[model samples]
Target: MNILTAMSSRLTVPFLDLKSQYRQHQAAFDGAMGAVIAEAAFAGGPWVERFEAEFAAYCGTTYAVGVANGTVALWMVLLAMGIGPGDEVITVPSSFIATAEAISFCGAKPVFVDIQEADCNMDPGLLKAAISSRTKAIIPVHLFGHPANMEAILAIAQEHGLPVVEDAAQAHGARYDGKMAGSMGLAGCFSFHPVKNLGAFGEAGAVITNDGELAQKLQRLRDHGQFEKYQHEVIGWNGRMDGLQAAVLSTKLPFLEERNAQRRQRAGWYFEQLGGIPDLVLPASLPEVEHAWHQFPVRIPCRDAVFAAMQGAGIGCSIHYPVPIHRQKAYHFLGLPEGSFPVAERCSREFLSLPIFPELTEEQVRTVTRVLKLWITRNHRVKNIAFSGKLAV
Candidate 1:
């Protein structure tokens, strides 16, 4: 059968392949989880400590604080940095709103900056223009598993005496210039959302840093501000990562590098297959960075039409962010116009994420690419017919 007929025979192909991942690691995962349950160490216990240490070592950092989730991870980092009311944090507009929401939750303003068209990470060139005396820190997101331009961002932060925080929620096991994403800044935040490269059964997250003092502060911050029981010293939040999630994460940690490697291989196939398609822009890999491929998003002209075509063809495809954060209703007070952040706005319209989990087969990759190319060609034909007297595609 042709690619379209083959896809149409199926009902729904998932955008992610979580079940395959779990099946591959079931024995070890079950044993670790059982151990956590048997110990009855549900919160802030030995398992949590063990996972924190292991994750810290994995990230090449001195300390890692397990938290409730990625959002809390960002919140705890911002709080630890002493960012508060009237302060502003600079970040890109192309991220999950959690990056901006974390700043707003801390009673600080999230100053929006545009992104580089290449990787959708923050454009460091625009960062300098956005900084003010109230700018307390820079939270650069490693969007879609690609590392931000950290070297330039780090240099700018160091020159201005600003602390750099990494929003590494989607970039587990991703590295920049031989250093891991979470270790590239003063503090790096990670998420164990089930969809990420290194995921937990449920919600979980952590903060990693080389600064010992900051590490202790985050520990206190997550646990009611008390190093000891019932001695509340400062305002804090209940953001501790449960031992159960820690156990799951620990079981999954050792395989992170291998899984990310598989993802890269899959991404390579997608690029190789679809890179030359007309009006389609494949994500670029930079020389200094290793992509985790948490998402293998492609930018195509008339993205919505292509999305509808893929869905009609029974291939699951989705957009990473249909609306840029700055343009969202919650952030409308920023009063940014339609073309305010051109790169981010354009990207939101054009980018669509494809199925790229490690477990996906080469056949599946070919299937997706074939469907996408066919759809794009058909759409181009329709456009040409409507505009000109001749048929095209």
Candidate 2:
């Protein structure tokens, strides 16, 4: 067999393996389901309430409202905070579109900001310049599960009397200055999609806050605006979390810390192996914050070539975001040009998310690193590629 044929027939590594996780925890999951079924509370019942309390405590907050999904959690937070038409919500441009979509859903315009190249998080220095009389809220995303520079952002928000809603969608157990991710700001929103560190079986999200009034407002908004059942006092939407999802989350929450530790260990392995590979840029991990390696995303000059090479070698890799939010077609109405956020746009072209999860064995990490090194060594011609600004994987 020739080198080409041998390279064509290699072991396949998945981006994540939820099936194995489910099978490993099948008994515990079955017991959780049995209890949920026996209670017969399928939608926003005791099961949901129980999980809400547990999650709120986990986040070090006094209240948590379980919503249908992360996007709705953002919308509900905006609505509960009375952010709507004619108001502007400031956030970085590289986060999931849901960050902006939630603000748009509440009739608010999302103001874009450029991110620091090192962390891919909102640059706190740019906050003041972007603030105006119309600016009402600041939503800083903990991109890639690394906490945002909250101290700086909070200072700016406080000076301007603006509320902050942390988009902790990718950061479940992340921390900044010894504070948990969802415990900061007026409120912090989380997503429990299947890929998240503490994911539920299906879509699930929560809004955690120390402010009781905001928490109560969220509770009412996630329901039908009824402070009491069948007593609607204001407009609301059906954003309730299903009981089964809550059960799944309850079973999963107890394991978050342990799983997060495993992810961190895996990150260390990646750094140890991939360090100093030419043309590769590793994102920063602030010494003061705890990074919850949700996705091991790296920036390389020719990310498309690196990603394609990994795929062809039967290794699973992905692009965290092929297009920054400001450049997306849906957000074109914001009237922002391609170069509005240059750093974010450049990152969109070069960002690559490698396979990462608590379940990834050390051997898998080695294989991924080995493949990356081999590809980078074999193809040292990225400087001459003349690539497009966006490389969709």
Candidate 3:
């Protein structure tokens, strides 16, 4: 109950600490919750509607359709595109399982693509070769908050007359070439999971698109395939965003850009402190892109050992993904043989997500860098080391 007790209990650094965020916005959060409860508008209500409008404007899209979760957002976009059964969707193997889960649940197969070793995003140069006669859609993920090469991807899609779906689940406010993440694709799917840049208090998602017809159909798909209540025109699942989650999102939406700016500043600290280290490869800060930094992922030799040291020192750390999607037990049915996605597979072994939330203080950032330097000095192999696409030896 004392300040000392509170200070002592908090972790020196945490991967994410929503507790601080909630405390900072307690009044607005409480007000939002009270309004939702007072209205008894539990699902698909006014709050959700308001959030969709606000989010659409923020993302620079014509429409934003709220859904139950990020996975549902992706599925609705695909269903709205009329892509399923006998269709294959192209995406990277470096992403979370939800990307592929949405595809499989829609009765479509996921064709894997390698990522850019620098930004960990889908490599647009390799996209053309992955296309097939049955490739109904292309889902390019903005992995770890960096925007994908939207201009190149869009050109390729136009050439092939294929629709592009951006898995912007981790890149809420990221921008590429001055445009927002979700605005470049046919539909940009977002997750408002608690850890995302624009997180809701709980699970929530939205789909943003410029096409009026596709946006309209996506809205219908998320609400049991109805233009209105109890009037189903097509088969759809229960994917409506709840009023409570929407209320929370609306309360937080105003502060998202400010929070994102802080995350950027924190990431700069990482780059400044860790850059040019021969044994450690920092995440890429590519040109013409603004990263939202949902996860500050780095690649280093002896990644697991470094992760253990960080966590052991109460500096929370995790692997972005230790296993690629193609190598997972669930995807064995796809029969994507080993070495199918070399870049993503290599990243799986090396990518370590460092704690880089807006709530993290500058001193905490310094502390993290200090510990990392100590560990890397002791364990990393510096012989003929290359970093950030250049030789460091």
Candidate 4:
């Protein structure tokens, strides 16, 4: 059958169907919440402690400190490490604003470096140039659930005697050369926002590390820097993770591996169906790493037109980011020009995130690809006709 004929029966594919995920395991969620309510453990208590231990073990780390959100997790880690004013943290500009916000909130400057086109991550080769005498740390984000080049980044950080704080918010089950996403850095920060691979029902985050001292300091930082009740040791904020979010996370933790596998399988299906379309760029994964496939972002010309077409076809699509952080109004004080980070800038303009979730079926994927292919064909035909008209004139 022709492509259009095959897709005549349309399916409405959501960008993320959280309701389906919840319905699949409603009983466990209800039970977990009930236990917390019965014990009156609403704040940071046994439930939070239980989840911290479980998550730490899962990440192969000695300590994990739960916090209010992923941005707080990153902020608390920097605060614990004493990254204050005049200090600069090197990171790429192609991540969520939270990554840079965490550093800026800690009274430090966030230095931006361009990303590598292949992985859309921090280019380790550009690391040295961005580092200055004030550079104290590095925060490499595992953007879109693909782990960054941790080995090279770590080597560079070690040479400079700076610590590495991995922004692993999107990469729960991702791995690089057999090492878990959050385990290779000095400290790894994660977000359990509702849309993440391993999400809590509400806002939650955590920091995992092997250093016992850093862990203790982080624990204190999240709880108003208190060693004991009513005794404040250092200036801190109310960053503690609530027991309800912790309970939700604990209940969902066991199924994360299976869900991640399902996402990977769906990603494979996209690769099979969307390969070799002219002028389309597919995301690339290094052979040494296992991606968690948090967001399947593809690059194509006339992205806005295609995005609108996809939406009209009832296929939910979105943009990972339409503006690079360096060009954001909040960062204008940094004085970065339009082309400061070309790779990230180009990616911002062209990247389109298709529907990708654990519950997305193979048939839904086929439908999305079919609609995308039809748009490409139409776009090319328009360009060809315009070119031919110009030649005849």
For model 3, how does the per-residue alpha-carbon lDDT over 1-393 read when each residue is reduced to its tens digit? 322223325546878888888999899899999999999999888999999999999998889999999999998888888887999999999899999999998899999879987688899999999999999989999988999888898999999999899999999999999899988988899999998988888899999998999988887887778887799999877899999999999999999999999999999999888888886888886898998999999898667766766775678888989999999999998888889889898899999999989988889998888877866664444434432221122
Model 3 misplaced regions, further than 4 Å? 1-11, 380-393
3 or 4: which has the higher lDDT? 4
The C-alpha stretches of model 2 lying farther than 4 A from their native spots are 1-5, 381-393
Can you tell me which runs of candidate 1 are displaced by over 4 Å? Answer: 1-7, 10-12, 385-393
lDDT of 4 by residue, 68-152 (tens): 9999999999999999999999988999999999999989999998999989999999999999999999999999999999989
Q: Write the per-residue lDDT of candidate 2 for residues 1-393, one digit (tens) a residue.
A: 322124537657799888877888899999998888998888899999999999988888999999999999999999999999999999989999999999999999999889997688999988899999999999999999999999999999999999999999999999999999978899999999989998989999999999999988988988999868899988899999999999999998988999999999999999998898778887789998999999999888778867876777778998979999988999988799988899999999999999889889999889888877866665554445553322222
Q: What is the lDDT of residue 245 in candidate 4?
A: 95
> Relative to the true structure, how large is the alpha-carbon lDDT of every model?
0.89, 0.88, 0.87, 0.91
* Clashing pairs in model 4, backbone N/Cα/C closer than 3 A: none
Reference-based TM-score, model 3: 0.93
Badly placed stretches (over 4 Å) of model 4 are: 1-9, 384-393
Looking at model 4, report the run of 10 residues with the lowest lDDT sum: 384-393
Give per-residue lDDT, candidate 1, residue 119: 81
- As a TM-score, model 4 comes out at 0.95
Model 4 C-alpha lDDT versus the unseen true structure? 0.91
Clashing pairs for predicted structure model 2, backbone only: none
